[model samples]
Target chain A: MHSSESSEVEVKDVKNAGMPRRELLRYFFAPKAIAVIGASATPGKIGYQILYNLKRRFKGDLFPVNPKQEEILELKCYPSIVDIPEEVDLAVISIPAKFVPEQVRLCGEKGVKAVIVIASGFGETGEEGKKLEEEMLRYALYYNLRIIGPNCHGIYNPRTGVDTPFIPERRMAKPEPGNLVLVSQSGAFLGALGDWVSQERIGVSNLIGIGNKVDVDETDLIDWFKDEEETGIIALYLESVKRGKEFIRVCRETSKKKPIIIFKAGRTESGARAATSHTGSIAGVDAIYDAAFKQSGVIRAESLEHMFDVIRAFQRQPLPKGDRVAIVSNGGGFGVVCADAIELNGLKVARFTEETYEYLRNRFPPHYGITNPIDLTGDGDKDDFKDAMEAVLKDENVDAVILGIIWQGVVLEDEVVEVLAKVVKKYDKPVLGSSPGGEFSSMMSEKFNRLGIPHYPIPERAIKALSAMVSYVRRREEFFRDEE
Target chain B: MSRILTEYEASKLLSEYRIPMIGGSLVNSVEEVARTASAIGYPVVMKVMSPDILHKSDAGCVKVGISDEKEAERAYEELLENARRYKADAKIQGILIQKMAEKGTETIIGVVKDEQFGHVLMFGLGGIFVEVLRDVSFRVTPINRRDALEMINEVKASKILYGARGRSASDVNSIVETLLKLSELVEEHPEIVELDINPFVVYEEGKGGIGLDALIRIE
Candidate 1:
């Protein structure tokens, strides 16, 4: 048994070795060939899913290991990794909880560099299961073996044809990957989010769910994400942290180089207790978490909906100038509500500069709150919403704009959205909207998304998106946006 | 002197420094409890002044609003009997007869010495809010005037002190000055690990704040 003193020394050595950016990211995103241990001919099992998904999503070689079945998905199967007669980059284990230890030991002896154990009921179960997990970790640590998760849903990457198969429809994006990497602790939520991304047709470089991390955790993943050339943003959804101080330290260092957005769930007492039961984490005082988030340049996501909305906006829109917002509305109350929500979030409601007003004076009725949220006086046409947005985006003083369309009582929904989308695509500025108008809202939302802008249901949510952009721009100015 | 300071004796320590506190006097025996209650004026309070007792109400050592000398004497006897029964070996430091102080807006101020940074002072809403709401703020001791103002503003319910609910505003500067003085007191006495002045009622603009009840613990 290795002493903890030597373990600390090994950690220090790894810390100082200056691992290359591409190599670390490759460990997560682009492993060359993978072997599926416990691969089954039986459909709907985890092992079958692993083998089938790898065949469907990846171009790399996939070897399925099953003792009884000579073949799976028409590919020849080896009973164990040692019998493969070739070098393997990764071994993914999906055997039953009782057989995981032996499979991992066999993989280690095969000299595979990395492993992803897609088995549950390890540490998350009672004491007996925990003892087994400790043994697995001891094996990994002593042999310098890297493990993703003993209880995770596994990872997804488009660049290396290494899709983990949870996302439906292989072509989620145009296959043009960008610099956004998602690291979540909830496999259930991660699965749902991956579906959302596919449906929304958003491109992601890497999406990982590190459940109950007995080995690699958020900080470890973040340290790798910071150095990766293709990753510009790191989105995190954590139920709790393994080390709050260490996590904050890494985030503070990394967020200075790339935008870091985090969503936490254990704020309330009962919620905190439930989180502990699920993750075996002691969620300490909420204030400390608050201080930690603020100290690190982490944008706090209020809800799952906001998580997707904020990341999508950051990816497409230009950095907002400041918090100053302009609201264009077809109703007085919609304009009023959006104004209050915008001010409440610490963003200034932009007063139109003289040049912007002089340009738009002949464009609409004088009753509009043109200094603010330009109210189009209820009878304004689709051309008015378009013209007002164009003027606002071009003003150069306004950081972002939130437009409110009240509905059929005012103008045709399609016509207004068409005009708005044209202006948004032209300006290349951050523009958000909120409409409570039935099916019309959905149509408008689709167009807003099509134009590469974000739209929501309520005024408050739009303001929150704008606030995130303002923070991102400021962090970027500090040249500490996201550091490796 | 007793091992634990009586209400009057403790008041003397605060008094010597001109710390604003409710006026009261000490009386040694039951007969003196009646005489002191008469001279201090009727409708006063009689409390067991045992040096060993910190929370007089819990010990059943408090009798409030005594109307006359007879009532004061009887109430003082009841208090002595209860304290003796509860803490039998305790030294009876006599009764304290004080005029019933007028009620006003309540607040709590305290100083607790922390291991990392020496004494830290706290200010916030008192009573149930301190436990359930935790509406309080803290800062390391020896604070300047600006730091004192910041501490007061840090609490969520500080709007009440700044005149919420259509009420008259308390003299905020006086409260800030008192906090500065507290920071100084804690600095001068490192042995005082815990000191609390609960329900420190302050009157309208002219009347200033008063330390109605004080509990100080020292190493």
Candidate 2:
């Protein structure tokens, strides 16, 4: 036993020397072969649904382990992980609480590098469950295996098609492959967010649910995704942070490279109690968390919807060079509303350059408001929007533009989407659209999204999203400048 | 779970960190009070030093504007009597005699140990700004110089420190230095769970500031 222990230590040292700690998570994200420990033949079971989801997307080898079944999902089933012939890089465990630790030990003996436990009733239930979690953790530590959770909904990666969320694809639509990565401490939130992302057509790089974070946690994910070439934004919905100092350190370093937006729940006293029962986490004072986020350059979203809005803005548009924004609207009221929101959200209504003012005055009649909002009047058309956007975008004083499109106007047609999209592509500054109305406006918003412009149902949300981007840029600059 | 140090002990600890304070010495008797007051120069302030009496002013154990030895002696006895009246069995340390700090913009700086994030530093303007409005800013400790500056500038009443309404600008750079020093002090001494330097009077720019009163809690 002593000789084997010494050899294990030596192997661990060699592994550590060969790769950084973050690289260990690669097996979970991009495994060559995977084994489902509790794969079931019956539909609607967690094991079955997880296997079905994996079967649809996972491109690697899949092995099913079920003692009761001869075959499942048209694949051969083994009695145990150790009995499998091929090497398994990852294992998804979905069995009763009593049997999970034994399976974890077996996977450890089988030399699996990573394991995702989908079983509940561990650490969150009672003393007995907590004891089971401890046992599993001991086995994982001895074998040097990385565990995602003792109770979690599992992970999904669009780039590699590694879907392990138990919610079936039909029930929860998987988003297309893109740069936004979503991580949630609550599995149900991820499930709902997945549907929302699909509905909104927000492309995602990965969706991870870290339940009862016994081993892998938000800090590990942030460190791993900070350097990931495919990930451009890291968004999280957290009830509580496990390692506070370490989380701050990793986020401070990562936010300088890319934006990290967090929607931390449990701000009020009643909410803290609910969060405690939900995840068995003590939500510390909310002000301290706010200070930590600010110090680390992490953007804190006010609500769940706000988080998605911020994510869409970061995902689709270039960051503004400054907080000065120019508004273009066909109606006067919408322009006025946007101007009020811009100042309230810590953004300035831009002061146009003389050239821009002269150019707009020459293009439009004297009755038109040709200053900051650049009101194109009720007769505004696609050509008018194109001219206004181009002139303001060309002005050195304007860092961004917010288009308040009242789609109900008679002259404003769907062709405005293509025209504005083409004009925005010519400039590097961010441009967001606000078109508030019924089905027609929603349809136009989707079209705008496809063309790389984030449209909001309300002008306030659009301004809020743009303000989040501006704050992120300001924080990034301040953080880097302090280092210098 | 924690022990609040007497004002004398708290002041000694602050001195170790080089935090600017209205210079004072602990006096054991009426004679010593007069000597310390005269040496530090009047008008001096005297307060009872006792852990049993947390709110010194509330207990009527604090006296200010002592311009002579006779007044210092009289105030010393009065403070001791007040301390005894407030808490008969209170453990008395000594009388703390500090030179009166010149008036400027009043500010507050403090540190509280959060269960999750450890020590967090807090800064705000004093008086109604903090008491009535609760306008303050916080940062996790071991902060950089830039964080210190931001904490000072983040408060709504920060304009008062910057010479708002025809007032001269206070020594903000001095407050930044004290905040950084306090950050280092707490970072090195994790057992110091809580500290407060209330009504830290700031003089005009380039003249510096001094902590007029302080309280320290340790676990």
Candidate 3:
């Protein structure tokens, strides 16, 4: 099984001798002309919604292919891909599973570089579907054509306007273009995540849902995105890895340059059974996955929410030089909670240097706590937070800072948001914010997000995110040191 | 299905990779047991080597603290009798006699073939720490010195190896060397599906360690 699988990849390597894999992937993400096969005119259909989403942002030439329709979404429609006048770089197949292989063969004949198979039945259903997927793969490999999925939501690149997910904008909010690239094996997760990240204002460059993964998988994406100028972090939701050794090798190399966070599902026995049925993937031993991720410098998030929490930090803040964190909060109880969290997460609460101690001592009253996790008292205002933040961030011992800002405090003005934002940007150290409350606290959290600091709902989440960053930095350093 | 290699064969294979083991000799006769026991010095250990008996200690086929030739002969007879009672039709290979390893901090170094990741090396404190608490750390094999050190430090009970209380620090460097050697061994021999060096006796600093007992399973 292993030899045959590698031979297929080698055949593709021979076919595209000069062009690298990353360069070839551009045909999928940045195609100049895209033909949507099985384009529909009716509302609420998969074909129509795919074209609908693409028509909103895709600036390239769009051709809708259908046997019966003359036009779709006011765009000129073609009866077949071969009849299209212009050269097609990508084709999106949205027909049923039984017809997907023939369509893929037609795509190969038309010399389309890549095709996204957005149907659901192939490989995931049972033996018959698996046979259909095998036939589709044969057609793709014959012409050196790359396929994304036999059952997937397809790719979305906000910058290039090449959105292919079938979910319409009315149902799912599109995220703005930024540095994070998310890839998942489950398409529904990508649809729901689009809404979640948009609500939280987390900017993403690309969101790819690779189902069945007959051709493209997480390892290929990681290799491509490692050199992608727009991407600084690569996040994945994987049920199983197709090529475990190759995945580890690529991740180990890419993680030295960019942070890769993964949330591997199927940790328990029943969960593994569910994952196997859901994607037809064998979720091998979870403990081995843990070791491989650590050995490769990949941060494994504990949950789906934790995945984004770590991504938010990686997207906005710089990597801390060490695991020493300093906490500054107005609420004494919140500061104490953060101190415990920092230690529990394998991070040390930084000891402030004597100079920093004297600096805060001269600024605040004796009633205020002025050590690590410095409490500014309930009456502490914006100036007190400003002084505390600046003094700790500038100290050489502190690598990062977590601000436990309580919006419910009486004297703490809203202007403290702007004040703390300015202080955080001036230093190279990472600064995370946590504000736990209802409507007002969320509004303040958004303000902090806009200013380039990730704010969690509670202090524990912030500390956990910060701990992940520290671990990534430490592992990356060790990997490079071993090479030297 | 997998078959377990006799302890003598397993030790020979391990020694070929330069992994330290308490050297032993396999003898078929009772007089040969006494000769080999005296050659290796007193306070030796003797065990019945057989393909059918995987767990020698549990089968009562193992005897320790044989300080004299008379005791060695008696223990050898008892080991053979116990082996027959454990499995009447067991095809006994021979008896193994070696010098008893000096007690130190008990540690375990092992390897198991993962279906996806191939061979993975494991390290942990021995006995209750591994059985009850499952305090162990793992690394995919073909690991380096850095990975070996990390595996040792990752276990929660590693402090015992670092000289907790009044005990002297064990020679962790020796354990690291053993882990690295085992990694290479598995890489060279993929047929080895599972391995265990339980209670690998670790001595004081620079004094090295000994594989007190080992088991290897292969397809």
DockQ of 3: 0.32
Superposition error at A184 for model 3 (Å): 1.2
**Best to worst by DockQ, what's the order?**
2, 3, 1
The digit string of per-residue lDDT tens for model 2 on B1-219 reads: 678777678778888999987757888888787778888999999999998887788899989888999999999899999999999999998888888877788888888777667878888888888767768788888888999999999989998889989999889999999999999999899997778887788989999998888888888
Q: Looking at the true structure's interface, with contacts defined as alpha carbon pairs within 8 Å between chains A and B, what fraction does model 2 recover?
A: 0.32
Predicted candidate 3 versus true structure: per-residue lDDT over A304-395, tens digit per residue? 99999999999899889998889898889998999999999999999989999998888899999998879998889999999899999999
Q: Whose DockQ is greatest here?
A: 2
Q: Write the per-residue lDDT of candidate 2 for residues A1-484, one digit (tens) a residue.
A: 2111222332553222233335558898999999999999999998888888888889999999999998999989999999999989899999998999999888878878789998889899999998998888777666667788877878898878778888877788889998988999888898999889888888888999898887788989998899998999999999888767778888989999999999999887441421101011122378778889999899999999999999999999999999999999888999999999999999999999888888998999887789878788888889999999999989999999998888886887789999999999999999999889999999898899999999999999999999999999999898789788
Tens-place lDDT digits, model 1, residues B50-142: 658877888898888789877887887788889898899988767778887777667777765544345666777766666567677765656
Docking class of 2: acceptable
Fraction of true contacts kept, per model? 0.00, 0.32, 0.32
Better of 1 and 2 by TM-score: 2
Q: How does chain A of every candidate compare to the true chain A by TM-score?
A: 0.87, 0.93, 0.94
Runs of candidate 1 exceeding 4 Å displacement: A1-25, A165-179, A271-288, A367-369, A407-419, A425-428, A471-484, B1-129, B136-154, B158-219
Of 2 and 3, which scores higher on TM-score? Answer: 2
TM-score of each: 0.69, 0.94, 0.93
